[model samples]
Target: MTLYSRVRPLAFKLPAETAHDLGKRTLRAAQSTRPTRAALSYAYGYDHPALEVDLFGETFPNPVGVAAGFDKNAEMTHALAALGFGFVEIGTVTPYPQEGNDRPRLFRLREDRGMINRMGFNGQGMERVKERLEEDGTPGVPLGVNVGKMNSSTADEAIEDYRRVFDRLSPFADYVVVNVSCPNTPEEFDESSPEHLERIFETLAAENDADVPILVKIGPDSPEESILELVDIVRELGVDGIVATNTSTTREGLESPEREEWGGLSGKPIADRSTAVIRAIAEHTDGELPIVGVGGVDSAESAYEKIRAGASLVQLYTGFIYGGPSTAKRINRGLAALLQRDGFSSVEDAVGADLELE
Candidate 1:
């Protein structure tokens, strides 16, 4: 059995958030020095020519990435890269630090291979993250910054919040994601409203002197029409792309008792739903809009399903927790093999291969 498979039972015993913190500490130490980082690279890194993907003006060594919320403060980016992820996206970072919801907010749905969290954008904030990036430098692979407003911010204040964090951290980002669809945060305003989204895109577009690609993260529970409407709005505003999706509040078909927890649902249960959203967006946009799919990606098959639906890339957090350090290597290797089996030359070629036109 794999080391993480052996240890996960013990790790799973701790509260989900506590276990996550401990895991990050271990990763931080692992990536602390050149030799140690090199050791990890030797052990876990998997590189293949067919896994390369050119997106966001940067070449991703592979299309599998660590989704936002895994490295909220930019800690462990290098470690994650060493573990074989093609890229790492940090934050939902606000202008200032946030305590986020009370303790016991993160729960494991072990039976369902899912998790429920009401983290409420809890993070170390932009300045601390900026300092860490400056100290450690961006990971060897592409880095993305997922920016969010403070939970308490109002509708208009929210725009300024995005502006502040983007201004501070965009220099470190290969691409930036405006997280307007987090279900765990306070509903101070219609965050996904067409007007609000337009304001956000316009504000960021103005602040984007570097012309950093700006994308939006959307949730999966919305009606397909509403979701596509939002997509239409972003496309009209010159937004760079979409992250489909965030997490879901839907508990449909869940067998785990923790399934009732009031927050965003991620991992296995949301997989099909998220992929459907990706396919819908891909088909609607006619494959013109770039999509970074997120929702229950835990294996190569799951990741490949999204890529076929139209995601140029896929990200995971809960999967990493369950799959352990070797997750990315395993997935990427499987992807390369899958591509060849399907007669596709690379990840870019495989994207949207399953789409059917009306």
Candidate 2:
């Protein structure tokens, strides 16, 4: 294991929220020209004949991406991209900035190799994030902005909350991710129902005259029935894609001393379940729509499983924490090898290959 991975345990010991900030602040301070950034790019970057694929009209150099909630602000977009993610999704940013929940809102289940966060959409406002993107001299890779509502906002006013961010972040975002899955927010978990989903998706998609790809990130806690219902509504509205699934509400299999801490659970525990949900969405959408899988992915085998199960693209955040900077590059490299061994010409051909297994 690399030194980065070795040091993670030390960071993981602190309060989850505090450690997250320290890591983000550390990354944020490392400018684009920092040697760490350059070394990260060189060590993690990978390319091949079949690695390139287009999602939501944007061409990604590779399939592995950094999931949102990792970089809540836009500060690290280019730097993370420079770190070798094919795409780096920033935010879960609200219309206005939010303090999120109080201290001890985040937890780490080390025994389960997972994390739970009730962070409640803490972030700088969309305008500031957009402003940061505007000021960056370097043009990074494709970026997806995950927009969420303020902690105090009700579900009834969620659209206006989402709209304000989309309006400002559109120019810099290759796609806009409508993040309605945040379990920490007051009504967020229940808001992913068929009717609420339809309203939020249709409203966001309507606001974009440029055909900007609008997608929703759904929680992993919902029933399969609810997921299928969401698929039907999204398909009918021509929603571009879905990010399935988000952190879970369940706290199953947690042996971590901090297991009882309240937050949305993510990482190893949700790996299988998230991919299964992706498979379900793939079946429901019949591969017509894109699905970006984002549950527990710490290896290429996990990532390949997502692709085979039906994710056109895959993302990671917790996996990065567990595996360190080399994680994305490692997954991309292993995916290429898996494709070769499976006799698939490209990753796209393997998409939904696990559907039969499903």
Candidate that would win on lDDT: 1
lDDT of 1 by residue, 244-345 (tens): 989899889889999878999999999999999999999999998999999899999999999999999999988888899999999999999999999999
| Pairs of colliding residues, candidate 2 | none
Q: Estimate each model's TM-score.
A: 0.99, 0.94
Q: Per-residue error at 158 for model 1, in Å?
A: 0.8
List RMSD in Å for every model shown: 0.8, 2.1
- In candidate 2, what residue range of length 10 has the lowest lDDT sum? 187-196
Candidate 2 lDDT over residue span 1-358, tens digit each: 6878788879867776777788778777765566877766777678776878777777888888999989888777766776668898889878777888787777777789898888887788887787788887334678888888877767778868887888888777888888877778886445666777777766777778877888888878778988888778877877788999889989776788777877788999999899989988888777778999999998989999999999999999888887876787788889899999999998888999878542
Q: How close is candidate 1 to the true structure, as a TM-score?
A: 0.99
Winner by TM-score = 1
In order, candidate lDDTs are 0.94, 0.82
